[model samples]
Each structure stands twice: as C-alpha cells, then as structure tokens.
Target: MAKHPSLQTSKHQRFWKNRRVFLTGHTGFKGAWLSLWLISVGAKVTGYALKAPTEPNLFELLELRKDMISIVADIRDLGRLKAEMKKAKPDIVIHMAAQPIVRRSYKNPPETYETNVMGTVNLFEAVRACKSVRVVLNITTDKVYENKEIDKAYKESESLGGYDPYSASKACSEIVTASYRHSFFNPNEYGKHKVAVASARAGNVIGGGDWASDRLVPDCVRAVLRGKKIEIRNPGATRPWQYVLDPLNGYLLLCERLYKNGAKFAGAWNIGPDLKDCKSVGWIARKFCDYWGSSKTCSIQKGKHPHEAHFLKLDNLKAKKQLGWYPKWDINEALSKVVEWTKAYESGLGVREISEKQIRDFEGFPQLNDAELY
Candidate 1:
C-alpha cells in the first residue's frame, strides 16, 4: 500500500501553521491528543465541549485550556454552540462531541440519540451557516458499521447498522452527515458553498490520561494504580486497537486533504490499524499486563453486559489508497506508549511534556514516500 508521509511532514507543516481550527470534544482523550497535535504544529485552536468528562482527564493534565479557546458547553445547545462557533469563525471544523460509551448508551438511550444524532444535525446546520468554514470532519467510531459477527473487515461502502444505543446513534449520525452532505454541502455545488464535509470511523484507540469508566485500558490503569484487579469483560472479543495518535494523525490528514481537494476527499473513511494489529481483548490485556510490570492482574467479569461486537475491524484500504494514510505503530508499540504515558501520570512527571513529546515522535516516524495500495 502507498504510505502517506508522516503526519506533520515538512510539506504540510507550513499549511498547519496558524491554521484556525474549531475542534469539538477537545476534553476527550482523542480530542485532547488532537488539540496538543494542533498546538504543536502551530494551529490556532478553539475547543468546545462539556468540561472534561472524567475527574482526571488528558485535558487538565496537559492544561490544554491555556493553549486553545476552551468553551465548557454541551453540543446539544444548538443556539449557544452556533453562537460560539460563529464567534470563533474557524477555517476548519472537526466535530467530535458525542456520548461515546456503548455501555453508558444502554442506560441513557435518549441522551445518546439526542447527542450523537441531533447533535450532528446541529453541527452541520451550524457549519452550513458559517461562511468561513471550509472543511468539516465528523469523528465517529468503527461501531457505526453493521456487525454480521463475521471476521471480515468493514469498508465505508458497507451498510450502516448498530445494535447498541451508542452504535446505532453513531449510525444515525453517519446517515445525517450523508444527508447534509448531498443536500446542503454537495460536492457538485462546491463552488457555491466552498465547504467540504467528511466523517471518520476509527477503531479502539488506547492511550494515557483516559480516566473514563468502562474502557479496557483506563480501567486497567486505574485498577493497577489502586492496586486492584482489572475486570475483563468479553476477553475473547477482538478489536482493531491502535495508539490514540495513530488515528488522530489520520484525522489531521483528512482535514488537510479535504481542505485542498474539496469533494475528492469528502466522505466517510476508516482510520484503523493494520490487519495484524487486530488483537483479541484477552491478548491486549496480557500485553498490557506484561508491559506495565505490575503484579496486579485481571479476572474475566461474568455478567449480563450490553451487546458488543465480538469481532470488529475496519477495512482501512480506502484511507490507505486515497489518502496515503498508514498506521505507524503496531499494537505492541501502542501498548508501550500507553504504559509510558500511564507511568508519567502516575509518577507525576510532566504529563503534558510526555504527551507532547510522544506526539512529536510520532510525526517524525519513517513515513512512506508515496501512496501504495495493498
């Protein structure tokens, strides 16, 4: 496959410098990482989302609010969201705010649908009214695709389906994005609107400073720190796990391409790890346990858990072919970084510096010279 240049490649460095970016969900794990990346590359960023969802979050660890125009608000507040966004007058918009937890979604289905579905509707509506915005990349999840419970990887062309509330809500968000794209921001009418919209679906992303509940990595980290056993649910279930920075790089690349090529780059794309990186949950737990050097252990939690896909993966061939994006670090490398970040946080050793250094390191990795299709 043709590999895209490393993120923040010298070719794209100047483009991101002083780039005005309006990013939603900056307090979340992926958003915090993306915010740091943007700041590293010299982007003027504005972050809007509910205050960091967790007590100890990447946002506060990095003191990200000092770097961007941080707004503590809900995405469902359309009038307030539109007003704040209009005031920011951003050149690019990345919508990432949503009720992201699958388990939490089951307990609060109404909130999930309202935020993920209608929140998307509000974002597009806001973007449509904003003349300064050129590109909008809505971040969804790999769960948006229908799960036939097979070992096959899903492509963007696959039908959208989800059994769980979080998954189904994200599917609805995808449909909403398509409707808005073809109806209001159609590529054919680019000359009139000058706005291009795209969405990204990524697999399980594990990294540091995620104190959110019910996630494997964070649960393990918190559990280890507290000297408790990590609870493992669905250990046999497999996932396409990549470092948080891996897909964040793809998101930045998508925004860059959409900014330059317009409709040619506007659509749903999967930013997932390579086929070899797709590991079972049990394997990931073992790897993390080994790397963490912890006497702490795990036990499979037996209970009636909400339904989750047993074997889920994304066919990232389109991203590799069209955008030259590639996963820089494999699952082990990703786990190592997670260990590094967790240690930094646990030891209280410059968490922000460590996180930023990792981002810098990722951008300097050996990049593919040209695009190759597998």
Candidate 2:
C-alpha cells in the first residue's frame, strides 16, 4: 500500500477554506463530528436535519447551532428540502440523514425505506434544483454489500444487497446515487452539467459522543457509567472497526478530489480499516472494558434478536490508492480515545475542548489543549 499524507494536509486546507458546504444529519454522531471538522478547516456549513436524535447528543453538547446555519427539518420533505438547498446555494452537498439503526428498521420497515431510500431521492431532486452545487457525496454503510457471511472484504464493484431493512434501504440509496450520477450528473457530460456525484461506504465507526442505541461502543459506555456489565448480543460477529475521524477524513478527501477532478472521481468508494482491525463483538467489548479501567465487564445477552451479518468488512484499497486516504487510528487507539472522552464527560470536564483536541491530533496538527469553544 502507498503511504498517504495526514488529513488536513496543506493542500486540503487550501481547498476547504471558505468553501460552502450543505450537510444533512449534522445533528447525528458522524455528522456532528464532520460539522466540527468542517468549521475548524474554514468551511461555511449549513446543516439541515431533525433535532438531535438522542438526548445529550453531540450537536447540543458542542453547541453547534452557534457556529453554523442549522435547519430543523425532515429529509423526506422534498419541497422544504429544495427550498433550503436553494437558500443555502451551497457548493457541495453531503447527504447523511437517514434511519440508521438496523434493529429499529426491523420494527418499522416502512419508515426506514421512506427515510433512507426516498430521502436520497429527495436530496438529488433538491440538488437538481440548486445550480451552485458542484459535488454531492452520499454516505452509506458497509452493510450495503450482499453479505454471504464470509471472510472476504467487499469492494465497490461488488453486487449490492442487504438482508435487513436498514441495509436494503441503504442499498437502494446507493442505487439512487448511481441513477443520479448517470442521468443528471453524468460524468460523460461533465462539460454540460459540471456536477459530480459519489457515494461513500464505510465500516462501523466508534468514538466519543455517540449515544445511539444498539451499538457496541455506546452500549459499553452506558453500561460502564451505570456500573453494569456490557451486553453482547452477538459476541462472535466481526466488523471492520475504525475510529470516527478515519472515515470522515476519507470523506473530506474524496469530496476534495471530486471537486477538482469532477468526472474522474465520481462513483462509489469504500472507506474502512485494515483487515487486521476487523474484530469480533466480544473482542471489542473486552478491549473497551480494559480501557475503561472499571470493575464493569461484558455479559452475553441471551435473547433471540433480529438477524444481522456475522462477518462484515470493506476493501479500502481504492480509497488508499486513488484518494490517498488511510485509516489513521487502529481499534486500540480508537477505544482509548472513546474512554478518554467519556471519562472527561463524566467528570464534568470540557467536552468540546477534548473533541477539538482529538481532531487536531488526528490531523497531525498541534493539539489545542486550551482552545475551548462552547
């Protein structure tokens, strides 16, 4: 593999400075981190999403509304979405709003499809109306692949399939991105439209400030805080785990490439950790327990749960070779950071300061230990 430069590399800063970015789902975990990163790099961000999905969410934790234009709305509302896009007149669009939980999808499949599939359609429709938009990056999951429960990692060219409603909905979302790319933002006609469209598929991302349900790290955090054992539903299932900033770095790098090269960079790409980091649920739980330095531990939750893939991973060679993006933090470093931030929050220390420091550290820049923002 080729050596890749650190994120926020000098050239990237030049590209992102003063750039207009329209980001959906900025209230969510990954979105909040990306929103903060964008702001730190000098991007003018307009965030559109429902209110923070979880109480004590990162959006409110960071007080992000004070930093950007935040619009509280549903992704399915085409008219409202279009009006907002028109108003923002953004140069780049990043679609992240969706019904992201897998178990929740099994409970309400209709809402899942409506939000993940049709919401994607509505975003493209809004993009069609907004002429200022030159790039659109839709974030999807690594589960979009047709999981045969094998050890092989999935590539961007592999067949798209999903056994669960959430996975299936994201597969449909990927198809929607492809349709838009071919029909509206066709690379062959780059001269005519001057718009580029791409979709990013990333593996399970763990970090601080995620309060979402049914996830490994959040479950561990909650259990540890309460001095209870962490519940492991599927102890043996393995996933390509990387820190949150690793994949977000890839997203920003891809966006920059798509903006400058246009057609050449338009398509689906996978951003994930190295194969060695694909750890089982039990392994992650145990490691996280060790990092927390608490008496709390892991306990297998015995119950018939809805079906989920036993083994999942992504082939990140394309991103590494083409975009010069690489996963910076391994599972160990990731879990340590999560524990560090969670403990700081529990001790009533400054979270925004810790979060910013993490970003700076990840970018190979100077850590802003005293750079406090509320």
In angstroms, give how far residue 67 of model 2 lies from its true place.
0.7
* Model 1 Cα lDDT, one tens digit per residue, 154-266: 99999999999999999999999999999989999998988999999999999987888999898888777888888899999999999998898899899999999998998
Model 2 stretches with alpha carbons more than 4 Å out: 1-11, 365-374
Report the lDDT tens digits of candidate 2 across residue range 111-154. 99999999999999999999999999999999999998889999
Clashing pairs in 2: none
Clashing pairs in 1: 1-372, 2-371, 2-372, 2-373, 4-324
Best candidate (score: lDDT): 2
Global CA lDDT computed for model 2: 0.91
Candidate 1 regions off by >4 Å?
A: 1-12, 368-374
As a TM-score, model 1 comes out at: 0.95
